[model samples]
Target: MKLPETAKNRLEDALKQLNLRPTQQREHVFAVLLSERDHPTADEVYVRAKKSMPSISLATVYNCLEILVSCKLVKQVNFDREPTRYCPNLAEHAHFHCNDSHRVYDVDLPQDLLNSLKSVLPKGYEASKVELSFHGTRVDTTPSK
Candidate 1:
């Protein structure tokens, strides 16, 4: 994947601030996430990143993602899944996952829903951030074989 000059510069700056050497494998993995819109798991990013960095290990990919997350270049998502996914968009937004395909999508819910959720909060409960996800499949779409 071709990473934009802005993304590369951002990555370079991040590595410098973190006092970490920039590597081809780490750059390739970071490029995959920055170049694509879909939030991807470590394995998914690894498959794409491996094209440019054949020697990159799965464990290495996970470690790189963790580093990126710590540097605020990437965000990790935990939504009742074994393998957490990472999002390149650091902006506050929600996601929806198609349970059938396991495809993730950004979501924009109604204001009423967000307001209603806050209204129902129990005592001593504070909503840090809203993360709403709707998991379902289209009625007419056939499931993967």
Candidate 2:
């Protein structure tokens, strides 16, 4: 998938600021992630990216993902006993895990909810950012195991 001009600019800026060398593999990997809302796993990304980079190894995919995460370009989500999922959205938002489908979806938190949590917290417990993930069985009769 082609990245938007603004998004591509932001990524290039990030790479330059971090003094990290950019490559075709890295650009394709990041673009594949940023173009989707589904929080894909490393293997999932590898499968998709392999179409373009036929020789790309799983290790290479993993290493590229780590680099992206370390640079704060991707956010990692750890769900119930599962491999880590990667998301490209950097904004402050919560996640909802659908137990039935084992899928993760973005959830918007209310301002009052955030304020209430902040107010009730003890002093010196500063909140710079918030990440809330709820894990539970969906309303479906037969939940996924």
Candidate 3:
């Protein structure tokens, strides 16, 4: 499962920057995540990946994902006790979880606003990162037939 040259270059460059090996499995897994922006769990990624890499195993998929997260090439998302999901979007944003559909959507807030949210913390506090999420149902606006 080989990615196009440009895609391959990007993935390899990122791994190189972290002084990590860009193995075929790692490249393939990253391709799978990039192909679909939707946040998917390890099992979901494994299913998508094995389509091309028939010999790939669930454990390998998990390892690839862990490496990507540690390298900051992807972000791990968690909601309550649910299985962890992965997101490739690195921008500063929040997540919206739809209670009805159980889907996660990225919510973009201005840099200033996100910075101000830290004000709610104590005066002596410091923040390494900020995470915000909202849970709600999507209202159906379709008119009755």
Candidate 4:
């Protein structure tokens, strides 16, 4: 999948700023992530990237992901007993994990609510970041016969 020109340019600039050399593998991985907004694991990324880069290896995909994360171009989401998922959304948001589908969705929190949540911290305590996730099954609306 081709990346939007703006996103490609931005990513290129970011790599230059970080003193990292830009490569096709990195571009392909980033494109895959952007194309599929759904959070994907390293393996999933590797599979998708292989379609464009037939010789791409799993290790290379992992390396590309690590570089993207280090460059602040992507965020890694973690859940208990589950493989780490990669997200390109850099905004401050939470995640909701569906119990049945095991799918994750981004949840937007009000700015005031985010601030209020930080207000509960003890004195002299500071949080560099917050990761809040909700886990529940989606309500089924199908009629039962």
TM-score winner between 2 and 4, please give it. Answer: 4
Q: How much lDDT does each candidate structure score?
A: 0.84, 0.84, 0.90, 0.93
Q: Which candidate order results from sorting by lDDT in descending order?
A: 4, 3, 2, 1
As for TM-score, the candidate ahead, 1 or 3, is: 3
Query: What value does the lDDT take at residue 109 in candidate 4?
Result: 88
TM-scores of all candidate predictions against the true structure: 0.79, 0.84, 0.90, 0.94
lDDT tens string, model 1, 24-119? 767788889987799889899999888877888999999899989888999887778557999988766678888888888877667777888888
The lDDT leader among the candidates is 4
Whose TM-score is greatest here?
4
For residues 17-118, what per-residue lDDT tens digits would candidate 3 score against the true structure?
989898989999988998876999999999999999899999999999999898887999999999999999989889999998898999998988987799
Error of 3 at 15 (Å): 1.4
User: How far is each candidate from the true structure, as Cα RMSD in Å?
Assistant: 4.1, 4.2, 1.8, 1.8
Candidate ranking under TM-score, highest first, comes to: 4, 3, 2, 1
Residue pairs whose backbone atoms clash in candidate 4: none
Q: Which stretches of candidate 3 lie above 4 Å from their native place?
A: 1-4, 142-145
Clashes of 3: 0
Supply the TM-score for candidate 4.
Answer: 0.94
- Candidate 3 is scored at a TM of 0.90
By how many angstroms RMSD does model 3 differ from the true structure? 1.8
**Residue 119 C-alpha lDDT in model 1:** 85
